[model samples]
Target: MHEKQKARDVMTPDPVVLPEDTPVVRAAKLMRDQAIGDVLVTRGDRLRGVVTDRDIVVRAVAETRDISVTPIGALCSTHVVTVDPDQDADDVVRLMREKAIRRVPVVEKGHPIGIVSLGDLAVEWDPTSALSDICAAPPNE
Candidate 1:
């Protein structure tokens, strides 16, 4: 059997984050700049919540709430579910599936150190070899 891959193997290291007090617009900006769908909300490295593009669209824009004036804390998903670095990727996938979550924060000693998304796991596992093919291919002509 293949050795189990740990969360550390697939998680993005030192993930870009925002403070709990950051406004929703700023968090959206950070996500856009990073080309990521979500960002971990932290307080000095301690995980607090998660903000996603969907959150902005649903809770702010769709609701006609002012993104620039609303704090991320108002829209972020608190009580974040996290995974340990040593946990197997399969287990992480299971947890995410059960929770209907697309991202999992990787934490150590009560502090977040990284993040993993569904896309991350897809690339790591390459179930259909799609990710492998993409990685093996050179830039598009």
Candidate 2:
């Protein structure tokens, strides 16, 4: 039997990242340009938090923070669960399921190198499923 794939095998590498002090607006723009839902927030090379599109809507916009000047660190989710590159993808699925989260950063030596989402797991575990098909679809303009 083939060995199970590791997190590195299915992760999307070189994920968009920004410093904690970066303005929330910049992170929003990066998400729009990259067609990604979240950006990893860092303090130096260490992963500090994560900011998702919804975070902007709920935390910044709804709260009326000045997006242009508000640092992403102020609104980003600081408590994040991460996986190491060598971890089994199957374990990642379990972690996601247990945490009820859709995404997890893949870290190495305290720095993020990639991100893995529920969609990534769908593609790897069941390519023919509807979720996998949706994950594989190109982003709508």
Candidate 3:
């Protein structure tokens, strides 16, 4: 039997990433520039965490923290839910569902090689599901 499609097969290779010590403002800028909601935080090629736009808004701005001096690592979700590149895609979907998260980093030996979002999965692997339709829908903007 053929091996099931793994995270690597469906992941978005070369996902947006930044150093863990990146200033919050810079990190948020990168996310805006990339049109992405989240950016993977790294420490010299090693996966560190994920900083979402929401994190900046709630963890920093909402809290009236100094964005210009605060580093993303302090505000990012350090307990990031990650998937191995070789893991089955089904597992990734299940994890996302349980966590209610829309995206996960695909890692290999502690290094992030890609990301697999619900939208990516829906578009490429689950075209008939309602999620696919929702994910494939164009943004209001």
Candidate 4:
């Protein structure tokens, strides 16, 4: 039943989005404030890329970049894998597996509307699973 659901049905809507030129430090702060792992990078209303907390750590901190001045676009993963809102959730899962990605932006006309994560899938498809339990749990913070 859930497997047949569409991306729009399962995705977390109104995902946080930021401009490409925004500073990495600011993005990091926003992520912390929102308790979110990633932010969709946009350029003039068009989906550009996705930047995650991991990207900040590995690409900025580890690389000794100036987070206060470095633009998130510089570290964001631009070769993003996206799915349409009308796409099947099952197909999204398959694409995630094939791409080795944990999250995918749900786009419409090149604008991100939502995001679907592995955790979301677990909760939808196997609510009793350990992963689902963890995902459904309240945020540790």
- Separately for all candidates shown, the number of backbone clashes (residues 3 or more apart, or on different chains) is 0, 0, 0, 0
lDDT of 2 by residue, 52-131 (tens): 99999999999999999999999999999999999998899899999999999999999999999988878877899999
1-141 in candidate 1: lDDT tens per residue? 336889999888998778888889888887777667788887766888888899899998999998888988788889889999999988999999999988899999978889888877766677567765654455443
Clashing pairs in 2: none
- Where does candidate 4 have its weakest 10-residue lDDT segment? 1-10
Compare candidates 1 and 2 on lDDT and give the better one.
2
The reply for model 2, stretches above 4 Å from the true place, is 1-3
The Cα error of candidate 3 at residue 31, in Å, is 1.0
The digit string of per-residue lDDT tens for model 3 on 4-117 reads 889999899999888988899999887777678899999899999998999999999999999999999999898889999999998998999999998999999999999999
Which stretches of model 1 miss by more than 4 angstroms? 127-141
Clashes of 4: 0
Candidate-wise lDDT, in order: 0.84, 0.94, 0.90, 0.94
Residue pairs with backbone overlap in model 3: none
Q: Say which prediction, candidate 1 or candidate 4, comes out ahead on TM-score.
A: 4
Which candidate number would show the highest lDDT if scored against the true structure?
A: 4
Lowest-sum lDDT 10-residue window in model 3? 132-141
What TM-score number comes out for model 3? 0.87
